[model samples]
Target: MKEICIVEFPSNLGLKEPQPGKEPGVKKLPDWLWKHNLHKAISHNILRLDPPKYSNSKDVETQILNANSLVEYAREQAYLINNLLTQNKFPFILGGDCSILLGTAIALKQKGNYGLFYLDGHTDFMNISLSETGGVGGMAASIVTGNGHEKLTNILNLSPYIKEENLWCVGNREYDDEYENEIRNSSATYLSLHELRKQGISNSVKSFLQEVETKNLDGFWLHIDVDVLNDSIMPCVDSRTPDGLTYNEFNELTSYLFQGNKLSGLEITILDPDLDTTGEYTKNFVTNLTSTFNTFKNTIN
Candidate 1:
């Protein structure tokens, strides 16, 4: 067992608010407000990394022209993370969005092959050609898998930062049929909520573990997005889905993953406090998450 540490990231995609839908429309907030308020609101349990603001923060352009700026940003964060990983600390990150996974994942690639226990509602495998929507969040996973956007793919000087064969997506329930098929074809594995409900968390955990052990993976990483939880439990996500994992179910899964002790890193993404109503979502989010880390800490210590 290893110690778990949190690394904070500050990034607000400066877009506009999305239209109401489960396939989330993009929403933009003032970057400064997001950094000062929303980013500040995340828990302080883990090591906090300083947020990066580029010279172009004030300039206006698509995330494309600014891709170089992002690459620079990724490099800096990657350096900090690689240094820490060498010290044998488990790196957990609070994200601007799931895209932050690219930088952190890149930093750990040198550790040899690792598995991804990806939890998300959307497949995020679309490229410029496949994406019906132009939102970067929708394409972030594909980007990390070396599917789209050179600026993103080139960041931290790595391509296909995560191996698709070792990546498994769990709890994703909402998706277009075409995209669902795409996930089936991709190197990744998809375990939906229906499967989870039918098979039970322990059974699902056992299934994932059996595959990993049989394949002989070097390590595993857990990437969690709040959207994986039901809209009833986590409504502050970028997009809210009506049906998903319950709190007890998600916590049970979390405890099992922690207890497994094969985790190389943990990354929590897609928390939007602005989208939250009474902060109940944020409270539960942090409380459930921190309690998880605490339990892991106690066991390891």
Candidate 2:
């Protein structure tokens, strides 16, 4: 439906800097995606941004690693996205982690309130105290919805980057006792993996879209954490959960989403190329992604 431009962020501050001697594969995603000719296969025009400087420092108060750097980086990212949208181009953001969703949401919030379609293995709704690692990635969804540290929630003095009713979280398979309570109390609509299977993927998505339509919002952002795929096929994530969608299922869901013109942009996150030693996963990912985009193009025409 719209011309696509790939945006790459090679920083991993959101997930915390890679431990010494261990590579943070998420930071290398841009290179891996480009190596596999993702740009060539998906779109003719590609835009690459310089990666933000890596920082391992943490805020003593919030226990969020690289909090300062993350704020600055998200601000810069929002600027870039705003510029792209002003040009009337759809951005396909290749992220370092789900924290990039903060930048995208800020950009959209500047224009108006918009919806979010989050597809991830984990709900990412943990608060600072409950989060095991205190990484922003784990708390990104909560932070964007104005539930976390003030520094993140009040970015640019705009809190609650997205409205609760406009947010739809899907494919989340991991949740603990506290998180379950959080979800129950949260205003955001959540579709767990179990419910998604029971209701059927197509029906689940259609139902979400129906709610989105009723909201009468500007548009929505699509976020995909690769861990949403089956662990057997995609084990490259930092945390792996059991029972995810098959490649065919992912493609079908993506194609259905793309068929709609309401999507303002899309972001793909949590893909660690370092784990794919054989490159089979990357190959399969590229194939599915390309096919999905092509399906969208066909629908638009």
- Model 2 C-alpha lDDT per residue in residues 1-301, reported as the tens digit of each score: 4667889877677775456645467988878888888878877677666556666667887789778888898898889998888777788888778888888889989878788888898888777888766688888788888888888898999888998777778888885667766765899888888888898889988877777688788888889999999999898988888899898888988887887667788998988888887778987888888877875764531
Clashes of each: 7, 0
TM-score of 1: 0.81
- Local error of candidate 1 at 67, Å? 3.4
Q: Can you tell me which runs of candidate 2 are displaced by over 4 Å? A: 21-23, 298-301
- Best candidate, TM-score: 2
Q: What is every candidate's alpha-carbon RMSD to the true fold? A: 5.1, 1.6
Model 1, 1-301: lDDT tens digits are 5545557665433212355322221122223223434334433445544444422222233333234545565677788778767888777666666656666767867666777888787666666556443445566666667776666776646677777777777887875677677677888877777877788889888777777788877777788877888888877776667798888888899888876656677777776756764566766766676676667754432
